[model samples]
Target: MSPQTKSKQRVRDHGEVFTAEREVKAMCDLVKDECDRIDSRFLEPACGNGNFLAEILTRKLATVKKLYKSNPYDYERYAVLAVTSIYGVEILADNAEECRKRLFALWDKEYTAVCKKSANDETREAVRYILSKNILCGNALTLMCVDENQKDTDKPIVFPEWSLLGTKLKRRDFRLDVMLKANDKPKNGQPSLFDVPEEIRKYLSINPVTKEFMAEPICEYPPVHYRKVQENG
Candidate 1:
């Protein structure tokens, strides 16, 4: 069994049980193809210390290293995308913080080895920002993220959707609840969840990063740098 829980009381109160490494790998293998895809999105609603997310990040980074080993520019972009694509919700404050740290460390290890002297501070900061947004401290069941104090906030859990547009990175924020409702349809003749007005859809379809289509992000981070660091290169 994975020795991940903080205490027996936590397990009893939260029903928290960390999955063993072997089992995590076995289960993720069922979706091996997706796991290997560098840009595939994954959400762990009840992530505890990021057992699943960590493995997923490792696999995606491996693909980045394999395909873009020679191109630091492409490697940096895709690696950031890989980190941005993972989402996790842990109710416990400590667990959420630990998960973020663990994931960052995992990424940094591979990044340092591959990029060597070329590592850029700005790029690393961007990754840290992305991880901060991706793994949240909140009640997944209630879809509410907590503040730094660990108190529930009125705001719903929000996540930024990242995309590479030519040489630029585009970000759009969306509510977790709204995204979850994407599949639902009302019986009455009404707009489906996430439906945009026809007039707005025209603009969104062409340029999704427009102000009209984008929602304000609940959290803020340093701007992302798209250029590759040339120190090691």
Candidate 2:
């Protein structure tokens, strides 16, 4: 097939053929062995079709089952551990959704097996919850935007916490608390403090700067810490 024609075809349909059993087995075995050797978590950032992830999941689930066979009551925990241990991120929303369904199907199969053997419903639902929580639609290149309109924005980047507050002023700092308090007060018994101070505005801004100029020097104060961590050994 020509490259253009081949590109149009899907490499992985549910009924698509994946031949070469021996080579595939060897590749899977290699992954399984390495995972065992290092005890490292695996991430497939661009898991286009889940060919590798499916195999890895199978081996990992098998390993978990074997390891926890004696204490079958903890089987749900084992399943959760296995599923959460492997992470995948895809840029395409469709692919990400498909990947979630694939993982959930695997979870359901494992869950049914455990529930049937344990004769319980609670464990099965717990497995469902864990699968739902961990398998998310996320882009590796960009953090998935929570805002529907910004779904395609590159790298939904967060400004560093320290950087959120631009710089400390020489006098009293322009704290978010003060800004918010100013914003909360009603207009005109005194001019609302939230109204940009005319003098400060004049000093900080140029004539044609516009509203964007008003927003340029921003600051973020850290969250109010209600509790402190213990430091004693």
| Candidate 1 local lDDT, 136-220, one digit each (tens) | 8888887888776657888778777776665555666667765654333433534332465442233232113331222234333
lDDT of 2 by residue, 167-232 (tens): 110111232222323334344334332356663343233224222222223333342211110110
CA shift at 1, candidate 1, in angstroms? 10
RMSD of 2: 16.8
TM-score for each model? 0.80, 0.49
lDDT of 2: 0.45
lDDT of 1 at 137: 89
Which candidate wins on TM-score?
1
Give candidates' CA RMSD values in order: 6.3, 16.8
Question: Candidate 2: deviation at residue 56, Å?
Answer: 1.4
Off by over 4 Å in 2: 1-26, 36-39, 117-125, 142-151, 154-233
